[model samples]
Target: MARTVEDAAGAPHILIVGGGYVGMYTALRLQKKLKRELRRGEVKVTVVDPNSYMTYQPFLPEAAAGNISPRHVVVPLRRVLPKCTVRKARVTELNHDEGWAIVQPLAGPPERIHYDYLVMAAGAVPRLLPIPGLAENGISLKTVGEAIHLRNHVLEQLEIAESTDDAELRRKALTFVFVGGGFAGVEAIAELEDMTRDATKYMRKVTPQDLRFMLVEATDRILPEVGPEMGRWTAEQFRGRGIDVKMKTLLVSAVDGRIELSDGSSFQAGTLVWNAGVKPSPVVRRGDLPVDGKGRVKGTEYLTIEGLVRAFTAGDNAAIPDLTQDGEFCPPNAQHAVRQAKLLGDNIVRSLRGKALKPYVHGNLGTVAGLGLHKGVANPLGIKLKGWPAWFFHRSYHGAMVPTLNRKIRVVADWTLALFLKRETVSLATVEQPRADFELAALDGAGHRNAERPVSENAA
Candidate 1:
């Protein structure tokens, strides 16, 4: 069990909610800045997150493509923040007026955790639509677990396509549809497609021609973050590789594995990867904190909540004014999330010791995205790069930013070994249902060998 304010004998407690890039980085900096205070028990830091680890989301696409190990993408909270108390729970409600938050643990009843300082770093959730059959079939690439599942699911689809004699079943198995053309969707499809292409070399029945990859973007272009020129180049590259890039398209429905598009095309796809944007956590709206029209907590340039100096917020949940821009808020990305977190930590420390808080002011550093191995696009420091150079830049930037030397070494090691070893394409899909074999053996009735199957996506 972790220590609480009572265990610290009424020390000033700092509560951090949601252990993502913002939450974890803020606590880490605080641990360093307040070392003496923590050692002398003058202050206590408690981080509450539903998960015990922080995921490096930038490498999630690579993890899905098996370019990086799934475990290497996540930093263990307890291991990283030893000086602070780590509570594996979700902060469902916050009462800033009373300095208490209602946290719901994985099990047991909800508990109120009081704090002198609060950090609302709870990141965004997927902005899912009410499209038909989407909830039943869509897969997301947000976490390491989801990345692992997607890798396995894509490989399993190949296996199904190879074994099935039914042409329609094989066609569906080979078809993979990805929604959204942002970083998540584009990189996900690119990596998985590369993996599938490599896996086909070992299979006699399946070939590159048998595969069908489609990318649906509601906007006119893909990867708008990297400029219009690069986005057009990326779309052209995908089209050159025989991928169908449908711009200004919307996924109307996906009922019973059949995809209906706004372009008047219908097809059956075994995989439907949904990377359709994200919205600020709804929990922020439910709280008393002031929010913008988009439901993000309104934060000042100092990274503190509006009118509440003790309350800090960053990442996807906070709409901090971009000092570099005249009237625009900071974009919700890893680049801003990480930089804001460091500044937020310093501001918190300043508030505790009667020092002036510094406003966060950083210009856009440009963007880098990996399409696959030796294939990418980047515009770092206003310099445009494509192909191998961009790919190298992407890896170098993310490799340096993956948090903790332990994870850094592991991620780099994965890349190094990939150059020498054959790509591992085996799918452990059964891991999703570990009880299948045990339950079959335990059954004593006549339907033991022929049990009715539960309804779930075969893709993931």
Candidate 2:
């Protein structure tokens, strides 16, 4: 039924499952390779995602730190893939054998889509643990939305702390706790601390030293990707700044703003940020795709799943071998994901033409992290760099890598302005609820003010 329906169009249909790093790049590659076919509608490409844009996640930390505007970190799929159909929908399930997928749009009923090719680049979600109060209070930095919200929430906490005279309330408000000492947690905590500490210097009754920051790591060391020496150096730098680094510690619970740790320590911290880890998107399992124990799709170096050559997978979703290191899979990082998407795209095009497939192989260029402002740590190309050079390199590398020329320019522009101007400490938290003022004004102190309006008036 699916094949017959798609065959009626007299063209091959390519369906991309996610509008993330892999999905966007794959569609762009297809659009470039089959430009003539796309013009004639001989080959149709469709990308379905909840958001119409692909977010450059590396810039997320800076975006949250207000070093870059939130608007510049995301690329609109429609703008990038003009030749492809960009559908703002969530793929509920995909059945490759049936050659069809069930997708739910923003407001419409679920619809079945038939396609000749499927790209399982659905990406990963924040790995959540079954801990109490986690669902209610913990925050993860997986999306640009989450990053921006965290920025606002952190600044708002400062506001709460300053407005109150209660020492307990102020301590609770001023204290910030970050669980997971990986790159995400370390960078986030570092950037946020810098921002808050700098911000505190100007606020009334608040000193930079008043803010209490703590990092809780289950492992003895953080940022194992950069090697132990560098990780320890990074941790030492944090400790020098008076930030507590609790190694080999775990967050047992965060119930009712009371945080309990595995080391028998307890604290009343109002903010709890979780960046422990990530697992493959649950959608992979929902679709019944072949995945490893960790829920990552099992795929070969050619970026194709086992027994399904036509269907390609990459990024965090697929568990492809790391040729650089024996007996290990590719680390789920931006560098590997971006490189994999480029090769995955070419492999898909080759598969269509019955051409030879090339295996994906890319070595780590090295890791660079911005501690804050002019402070950073890096191990780029095996050269260990610290202080200004690493910090500048960190900014420059990420600035160059952020997708699209428009965004790259804007991000640099934001940085350039920062040198001459102060970092914007104003928290536009109201962005979360833009209609609150309107809703209040349009009320009668009981119910909605326009309840008696006709359908036509309400619509207007």
Which is the leading candidate under TM-score? 1
lDDT of 2 by residue, 1-460 (tens): 2212233366888888988989998888888888898899788889999999999887778889998898999998899899999989888878888788888888857778898888898898988888888778899988889999999999999999889999999999999999988878888998899899888877997888889999999999988888999999999999999899999998888889898999999879989999999999877886757899899999888888877747889998889998888889998988888888888888888888889999999978999888888998999999998889989999989988988898889989999999999998888889999987666555554665766655445444
Q: Best lDDT goes to which candidate? A: 1
Candidate 2 CA-lDDT value: 0.87
Report the number of backbone clashes for model 1.
Answer: 0
| Predicted candidate 1 versus true structure: per-residue lDDT over 359-390, tens digit per residue | 99988889999998899999999999999999
- Collision count for each candidate, in order: 0, 0
User: Deviation in angstroms for 382 in model 2?
Assistant: 0.6
Identify the runs in model 1 with alpha carbons over 4 angstroms from their true place. Answer: 1-10, 448-460
How many residue pairs clash in model 2?
0
